[model samples]
Target chain A: MDVGIKIIDSRGAACPGPITDLARAYRNSKVGDIFEMWATDKGVKADTQAWATKTGNEILETREDPDKIVIRIKINKR
Target chain B: MKKVLIIGGGGGGLILANHLDTNEFDVTIVDKSDLHFYQPWFLYIAFKGSKRKISRPIGELVRPGVNFVKDEITEINLDERKAYGSRKVVYNYDYIAIATGTSPDPDSIPGLRQIYDEYGDYHSNVYNSQKLWSHVKNFKGGTIAIGQASPTCKCPPSLLEGAFLLEERLRGMGMSVGTSDPLSPSNENDPTKTGEKGKSRIVFFTPFPRAYSAEPMNKVVEPMVKERGIEVMPFFDVDTIDVQNKTINSLEGDSLKYDLPIIVPPCKGPKIKFTPETVQDEERFIKADKNFMKIPGYDDAFAIGDCNTLPTSKTGVTAHLEAMTVSELIQGKYSEFNGRINCPFDTAYGKATFVIADYNNPVVPYPPTATKHFMKMSMARIYWMTLMGTADPIFERFFNITKPEKLNRKYSVPE
Candidate 1:
């Protein structure tokens, strides 16, 4: 989807960073603002989805590319 | 099925209550609080580093095959193997797992109880993550004092994190930090080191001879504290808190004053009426052998958790690790619990350091990094998920994942 997204490039960042930043972006963002995060922590992808489900946000897409897992999330009003 | 009674619905107790086979054991879980909270998150909440709703009603969380009882336990007749609760209810168990945990006894300390009676977990209970949200929300910058009201509070790294988080909280408010002129650097705890016009100074006090109880962590933390411009006063035992004067007096003829004191009160054990054999000290911390097995005399009883005199840090992680051994011990098996504490220390200015230690080892210095902080954040979710039975058990066994060891039950059940 063609949307203005904030790239939270937490590449090489650890566990909480990716999701913590994602939560922050979700808070600061307007509806439809996508937060795309890149993290080297292998658990980030699964955790991101889990966080999304808990917070009532949507994980738009998750892709594994190169050395990091990339996740895109949409800020939704819960 | 053997009747098992698990006391307290917190960390170690809850984990054991969830994992124990219902088909083989009739387990009953009782706790005073109707609600169960994800406690470790209280650090983030108190520091204003993160805001997430981390609580759930205990009624909803107790899994199938476990009888949940919400009652204030009045007494435990260890000799009779019976626990008495409010409403004159009596419970008999063939086996018991005590995980009642520790407490920061404000009542035992003069002026501290008054402080709580006035401020209500201003530092301690919030640190316990029991009641923290409003405290963190209303917090503004000032001369913040993070001190230990007494010795051996759970999670020694807490105040260090509190100061670090407060530093970040104040700075995030556009406060000038690190410099006396709000621009030029002075020494640690310089009067003009915070807020819009330098309205903050962070002072940390501990009863320990060093910044951390563990010496190796001190080696790493002392320097970091210096670099962050945090002042530390060690070997100071807080005896009296003269709230009227805003000064805490030490037993050793010294006094330190503060505008806001975020202190860890003295940790005291629960008042369970266990037999002398079941407890270690006068405080009633449970007695478990090195392997966290075989509580002397009561062969049917196994104890683990912060309430135990485990010769380790009284932390949720420690209790979680030891729970594995306690469960096996109840089943006539022996499992050695290598007391481990994996902690992440946040400088709160977008930086963190991970501290990994065991019962005997002190933590060596490691660089503050984002990766470690991330792990700390992820751990909370993983822990809760595992407890909820949605996540795999392997998630809870993070460190033990790779250890190719035997899971053997060395002892046979008493026929």
Candidate 2:
């Protein structure tokens, strides 16, 4: 069974801090799991896209509302 | 065994020396000064009073087998493959790397040095801190003008950083010097209102049309400057400095007065002789193929860092990336010379922005993209760690991308 992890909303953090935290959390989780990150920093959208491209991770979805960014990632069990 | 001699101990010289393999080529580094400074942190040190803990003894940065020489290089006899230094030592090398960085030439402007010496309190940065600190404390709201004498200046953001932080500090002290008239009447009369001495009103001026000529940065810096309420007078070249009058004469028949003036002087490469064949440009900057970093005609001699006249900004990050490319070319790893190199820059908000350069075509091109700020920050850590004699695993892997033989092919000296 795959595990689902969530990063409870990072609203006002600076660049790379939120992304770094999310990356660190994802690294500790088991392969083939799902990670969801909520952020308010608009740069996170580009950051997540770049992270996925560099790391070869799968991005399930990225949703943007007025105040926050919701992103979901599926880790490939390699 | 190949002998590589590197001149200058700044960011470029040190990193290239650190990156070379110990088993293959013997490296010798010659530098005039013993101290290795983390210059990027100098601005932070001046404003925030934060000391950078990143420096190390110059000796520690060199690889174990590499020879370190402390002397100023007097001349380079490129024809004979020998270099002479002030210590009366003649060193011969199979290859030479020039990384000597630029220095401020205050002497170029008449009366500028005298003014600087007399009004030392106005400009406070890494070079002159004690005077700068005292001046800042005693500043009592007058027109503060920051200007650059020439182009090709390093850390253009330093002036902006100082202005912004000074404004914030002054405001915190209840001295509200707005952007319009930094030395408002209220600021001059009330010494206590200015933090320590009631210094108010600051104005920033640059000779360039834009804050930074480089793109992406140019896009962001102007907004930040205006946001900080710093007045920028573009294209105002200085003709002379009238120290007695506390005024500056501009080439365009304009005169600007200042209570305090911080001037960034013009920068130039050190006086060194290169064989006419070696340097194609009149300026004597080493002429190298943009793609391979190889000196035209001379296979053994290569130039890196500020010493060479590369088209890109003369920053440490650019030097590091170029060194990697040059190393790969020297190692004969042509296959890996995929005509692309990553140039990373630090943004206004302290984020690491980068562009990819493709050098194969006639027109060198760069794409607009930025990496995670962590990656940029981590690279800085990697540089510090490597300089401190600890090879991080991540950087080591990154360095291994291009084989050594590919690097050697592009830089072979003629027999």
Candidate 3:
């Protein structure tokens, strides 16, 4: 079964704000679920990637549009 | 007897030096420059006719017992626990406190120094009140753009103060005020050129999306900017300056031209070579434990003030509080240092100001108000008096003494 978690894209929320919100949403999710984060900041791509790598999660896919970007991460079921 | 050596004789260094007991430890303060500036007042000094009142000789601020050295520190040899100076003197320390506050590097931007050289002789880089007053008195008004080049820049309110005070001073000089579209090049190529000859327009640009990144303050400042008719352009990094044209190009493809531009260049730690482990974060700012103010892996080395990567605003007040905490730790009287820092700011009549950060939490966050006006003024007086050796004992006691429970609470934050 595939579960989709949508994080309202916090594109321009400034430093630490978007990161904090993403962490909160990720924490509330179950193992093996896909968390989708929408962010508008160019810095968020590297930030979210770093966050995933540090947490041992895997990025399933990332798609970017002009104004916003959507990132999908697969949580490790540790 | 443990010897405490403090580098940089600015607000943070001086506060730490004063808080330490002279008899117990031999404290030596070293700074490269001969003059110690009341830096916060540079804004007012630039425009007001009272520059002399704001700056005092560095010698006046040192306590009777402290040894002051006038020399530039070239390097900090942490492995050997020594600092070398241009005077060829090497001072070793039982405890070292780093408080060399931030310095602007104008060289980082193209054409910045040239523009500054041509147009800024009347401005104070540190404290040029005469220059500020001269610029204000010259009176022809055009677009005034204030921009911060880096995220770690000191004192955002200073830029706000410049905008407000310039407006007030220009109006008093019989110049009219006008509003232009936000000064982004994408919106219009020439915002300042479109203005009338005698009218002054002001535009403020920040790299961040909001006026102030910190909450509540941002909320307050955003509306205040709107109310004051100051154009706010957020999230645009400055790419370069066209010195010939007096225009600034943004990384986001926006440009702004100004008649007089007061730029706050990016600030960085003092030029010091340190091992990766000795410094913290991407910036080479000396790293200290969040609570104890101790450099990790080194017992005797510590950092306080803007030189360190403290989470709080890089103001004198934060340094003073951290100095008290670090002094206690150095004397072995306290096992740990703990305190919360809250930077309180005020915006009055479109001019913004800040007061001593009230660390007593839950933080009482408020915008600049009437009461804060007196607080800011009195605090400036306290700073001046302390530096001048004339502060009453009561002010010293209030800042130095801390309750045990508060200390314990602060240490609870994980490093």
State the lDDT of candidate 1 residue by residue for B31-124, as single tens digits. Answer: 9887777766777766663567776777677678888899877677667889888899998999888878876688766788776654444334
Error of 2 at B357 (Å): 7.9
Ranking of all candidate structures by their lDDT, best first: 1, 3, 2
Task: Report model 2's TM-score to 2 decimal places.
Answer: 0.66
| Candidates 1 and 3 compared by DockQ, better number | 3
Per-residue lDDT over B1-415 for candidate 3, one digit per residue giving the tens place of the 0 to 100 score: 7789999888778877877889999999998876777776666666555544655666768878888888888787888888888867888898888888876667777977775554452223543345545666775867878767555566545555666666566656756555643322233324435455666677787665556544334555677666555777765456689988888986545788888776766667778666435475445577777677778888888888877755445666567667777777777777443343434354544333332223222222244667656766666667766643356376447544433234335432322
lDDT tens digits by residue: candidate 2, A1-78: 335565535444321124534543443566677878877544567666755664567899899877678888877732
Could you tell which candidate, 2 or 3, scores higher by DockQ? Answer: 3
**In candidate 1, residue A17 scores what lDDT?**
28
**lDDT on C-alpha atoms for all candidate structures:** 0.64, 0.58, 0.63
lDDT of the structure predicted as candidate 3: 0.63
* Displacement of the residue A11 alpha carbon in candidate 3, Å: 20
In terms of lDDT, the poorest run of 10 residues in model 2 chain B is B359-368
Model 1 regions lying over 4 Å from their true place: A1-78, B49-51, B120-142, B177-197, B276-280, B388-393, B401-415
